[model samples]
Target: MTVVSHREDRVQAARSQSSPARSRSRTGSWRPASGHVFVSGYVVLLALFGLVPALYSLYLAFTDASGKFSGVKNFTRSAKDYRFIPAVQHVAVYLVLWLVTLTIFVVLLALVVHRLTSRRTKAVLRFVYYVPGALAGASSVLLWLFVLDPAVSPVSKLLRWTGNDNFAQVIVPNHLPAVFTIIAFWTGAGGWIVVLYGALNTIPTELMEAARVDGANAVQTALRIQLPMLRKWIAYMLILSLAAGTQLFVEPQLVSQASFGIVGNDYSVNQLAYQYAFSQNDFNGSAAISIDLLIVALICAGFFVARGRLFETD
Candidate 1:
């Protein structure tokens, strides 16, 4: 009878231990399932919004409107087009100008603002600077068009140095792009200044204080300490600016319209593509141009990723 009681007690203890183990196993399994569910949803959203469109565009780049595959014919044809080289050159020049302007003017302006004032004052200045960004694309281009005019513009005093009538014709073939670059910078640099200012604010205040205590001047601290700390932010800004530079459309497009055929219809790469697709009804050519732009954007993205500066710190 005692042996029977001992055996029953051992069985009960085993069951008690096994019960907790089983419960823990169930809980662990459930956590993985929940995680998998979340990952699945994320992948689905990415595929729908990102992957699918990208893949479709790729397909379009290789095919005609009738859905007949042409392999690399579209790409070759686009390259051979009369306007291709000039359009590429135009965009390249614009990119260089735009990126340089953004990097130099925006970063310098932000740093100056950071040094000169209190946080409240800086905030107000940033708002004032960013006001131009509020202007619609059409509005900005139209405003600049008027500003470039010798007869109508208040800045005609400055324009007269280059020949009032000749200067008013500034949007001529060779000089038009430089004018566009200046207009774009004036309208765009403010927002970037605000962005860099935010980055400047993230620098540790103690670092600045230490530098000051060590007898470092404000200029020394800004150039040596603050700028180095801002490397990642600056890299991010460069990538963004490069991407925006490649997407230059609205400025040239509106300028083309406002100039009344003075700025050629094919003045910009995007304008060339639009003329191909809408006026010429060449969807393949349009897709090819789009793919070319996409490749440039991808290269920029790849550069940021390869540098390990795209997202949060490694």
Candidate 2:
């Protein structure tokens, strides 16, 4: 009986030690498998929707109507189109205006929101900010058309005061850059403000407190401490904004239709590409326009990634 009891004790001790090892192994194995499952799905989607289309665009850009490689002919052909330079100029002006507005206002609003001590107030304000962004792009643009028109708009007095007594006057070509910038900002900046506010939350409270202890005022602290920490977030916003701005299709296209071609069919690079493909039946030219925009986007993204040290660990 004594011998049997001792053997049972030894077995129990061994089981206790091995159980933890088995649990650890199970945990480690499950984690990697779960991670792989999530990542594999994303990778598959990106390859299918993002990578494949880009590669096909590249092929189309370099090939002729006969599917033979035509070198840079398609590129030069698109560039020589009469409307090309104007579209480029319009896009340039809009980008410059929109990017500058986004940088200043988004960051400023975010800083103001972050300064609020009441959690409920912050939550409500964040929701309010994001509400405009919830509207579809076309819907937002259409909504703004009414707002910009003095005839049927609630802000008719304000529109008239600005010398835009009619929709035509409001949407004139010279005013289109500012008009587009306002539309883009109204729909886009809200979401970015919410994003920047969230980024501000990720900053450690201890650092903020330390800054306060050193007699740093709100403006000083934001400029010296918080803004510096938010460099990467701002860079990311700029990169994405630049990409979306360069592909400015929906606003100008819809506006052109609404204004009876006052804004023109080729008001943006993407619109020019659309006109090339469907209107002119020039697929290679359309692809070349798309490739040009893609190259610009890639270069801007690379610049931000490098200058912002986006991947570096804190």
Candidate 3:
């Protein structure tokens, strides 16, 4: 009876020791269906809204007015339009100005905000930065029109200082790129600043402390540690900004209408596409133009992803 009791005690101890290991292994291996359930809605929405439209547009781009496969005829036709190249050029110039300004300023502002030690100050500043993002889309553009109007604008003197004595002068073809850049930055930069600031907060305090111990100054720490850590976030910002810049429609379109054709109907590729579809009744040409923009966006995204190693788990 004593020998049997000793064997049972040993077996029970063994089971107790192995039970935790078994539980941990099961926990690690047992991925729940919840993740798939959560993602299903997004996948459905994407398919319904994004995939469907993109596929239809792709089909339209390759077909003629009569619905027969026309190869690249629609693309060639859109390219041959007099307004196409110039619209593309305008969008290109605006994108360059907008992207450079956005990158420099958003990163700088985010860094500055992140350096604030007081939680209240950080929160207040973040709220202030995000305030402009609330006025997005057409309303933001209209608000800018009012702000840029030298005649009644509160910054009229500043505009006068820059030789822009009226809204017309402010939005002149020669200055439209800068004007659009400013508007875009005002409406867009705030959100990105908040995003980057949040990303900066994710950096471990221990790493920062180590940097300090190693005699790295603020600038060195930022450049070497923080910025490198933020590579994926910055890449995401640039990709989205590039995509938005290529679309360049609402602001220029509203400015054109407000300025009574001064900005022209075909100020950007999207506007040109709109003209093709509505004014010229050329859906194929419009789809072709859209495909061009889509290609540019995809190429830009690919470049950023490659350079930033965005998909790498490490």
Candidate 4:
């Protein structure tokens, strides 16, 4: 009996140790459950919004306006359409003009504003600059249309240099794109200037002091010390501006309206897509065009991501 009791006690002690081991194993397993829940929620949201819509758009691009499957017929038709090449070229030119001009102007303006102002003054200036960004799309375009009117414009003398009699005549068909680009920059640069200023503020004050101590002039300090530190922010701004440039509908569309027949109705890729979908009643072709623009935007975004210099590091 004594031997049997001793054996039973040993067995119980072993079971106690095994119970704690099992409990720890269960606890380890439970920790991953929260991780799984987070991952599952993310996947669900992606499918519901991002992936599903993208797949639907892809499917639509291969179909007719009547919802009948047409394979690549719509895409091929769009490619061979008369307006396709011209529209592509126009967008290429617009993108170049908008992106390059806006970047240079915004960066320079932001740098100047940051350098020559007190904090309170800079904030107020930033607010004033960003006010144009608050204008609704239609309002901004309308305002520019009036600003471009030669008879009423305060800058009539400058417009006369372009050999334009009136605003309408001044912005000839060929010059319309550049005119619209300038208008866009005037309203849009302010917001980007603020963005760049924010990035500029993040640079270490010690570095600026050190540069000053080394007898570096203001321009030298800005070019060598400040600008290099802003490379990532500049890259981000460029990528975003490139994306926005591809969606150049408002400027061209509004200008087309304001200029009557002076500017072509379908002067941009987005306008062309709208013409296809709405006027031509060809949803598939429009989808194809939209998908093409999406691809371009994706390529620009990918370039930024691959460079590993877009987002903030610290």
The lDDT for every candidate, in the order shown, is 0.80, 0.92, 0.91, 0.82
Off by over 4 Å in 1: 1-52, 166-168, 304-308, 312-314
lDDT (Cα, tens digit) per residue for candidate 2, span 200-238? 999999999999999999999999998999999999999
Candidate 1 displacement at residue 86 in angstroms: 0.6
What overall lDDT, based on C-alpha atoms, would model 3 receive against the true structure? Answer: 0.91
Error of 2 at 18 (Å): 4.4
lDDT score at residue 88, model 2, on the 0-100 scale: 93
Which ten-residue region of model 1 has the weakest summed lDDT?
Answer: 305-314
Colliding pairs, model 4: none
lDDT of 3 by residue, 1-314 (tens): 99999999999888868787666567797566779999999999999999999999999999998999999999998899888889888988998898889888999999999998999999999999999889858998898889899888989999999898878888888788988898889888999999999999899999999999999998999999999999999999999999889988898899899998778978899999999999999999999999999998999899999998899998
lDDT of 1 by residue, 1-314 (tens): 99999999999889868787566677785334666887998899999997897788788889988999989888888889898888888888888777777777887889989997587888788998999989887788888888888888888878887765743377777776687678778787888888888888888889888999999997898889988777777777778777777777887787777678777778677878888889999978888887898898888767865563556664
The candidate with the higher lDDT, 2 or 4, is 2
Cα RMSDs of all predictions? 7.2, 4.2, 3.2, 8.1
Question: How does residue 39 of candidate 3 score in lDDT?
Answer: 100
- lDDT (0-100) at residue 33 of candidate 2? 67
After superposing candidate 4 on the true structure, give the runs of residues whose Cα lies further than 4 Å from its correct spot.
1-52, 65-71, 311-314
What TM-score do all the candidates reach, one by one?
0.81, 0.90, 0.92, 0.79
Two-way lDDT contest, 3 vs 4, winner: 3
Model 3 clashing residue pairs (backbone): none
Estimate candidate 2's alpha-carbon lDDT, on a 0 to 1 scale.
0.92
> Can you list the residue pairs that collide in candidate 2?
none
Error of 4 at 256 (Å): 1.8
